[model samples]
Target: MSHKGCCYDNAVSESFFSSLKRELLIDTSQHSAQQAKTAIFEYIEIFYNKQRRHSTINYCIPELFDSSFS
Candidate 1:
């Protein structure tokens, strides 16, 4: 969390949700809560965190970008 009344507090989260809606939820429909949970988990862990290239990190996979620091 950031300081009170900070405008940038939700910037990262908002961007992430926007991408998630556009990339994963636009075409897919989940029948149940469990199914939605599973789909979101896979989208984040398998695709977003691993396979997708992020422009913010020089078009690198987020996992790879994190690994480079270690």
Candidate 2:
């Protein structure tokens, strides 16, 4: 948690949501809550964490980056 009124506290979360909105959610049409949840889960677990390369980590997949730390 961050101190009240601190914008930087949510910057990383905001960036992630922005990417989610632009990448997966934008192209998808979910007719039910379950569908939306499933799509979000797959997007984060499969695509975002495993397949997608992040520039911040020198274009490496997030799962690989995390495994390196572990």
Candidate 3:
């Protein structure tokens, strides 16, 4: 689908990466690509996509997200 006018298309992806970098990359102990990848995977799968709630999701987590529309 064309996302030319859809902020929703890019918004969550950006927010997720920002949170991951802020929480993982800025940590002085994370010094390697492997460490960064592990941290990001954990953050995305465990935190962002599962436990952490989002205001945009009407405070629901990803498992509760609707797929009927964008």
Q: Model 2 clash tally?
A: 0
lDDT of 3 at 63: 69
- Each candidate's clash count: 0, 0, 0
Runs with alpha carbons beyond 4 Å of true place in candidate 1: 1-7, 66-70
Least accurate 10 contiguous residues by lDDT in model 2: 1-10
Taking the tens digit of each residue's C-alpha lDDT, what string does model 3 give over 1-70? 9667576788877777687778766874767989867877887778877877788878887666855355
Q: Per-residue CA lDDT of candidate 1, range 1-70, in tens?
A: 5797564888888889889999999889999999999999999999998999998999998888999999
Q: Model 3 off-target regions past 4 Å?
A: 1-9, 64-70
Question: Cα-based RMSD of the predictions, in order?
Answer: 3.3, 3.0, 6.1
Q: Model 2 segments beyond 4 Å from truth?
A: 1-6, 63-70
lDDT of 1: 0.91
Q: What is the lDDT of residue 43 in candidate 1?
A: 96
**lDDT of candidate 3?**
0.75
What is residue 27's positional error in candidate 3, in angstroms?
Answer: 4.1
TM-score of each: 0.77, 0.77, 0.57
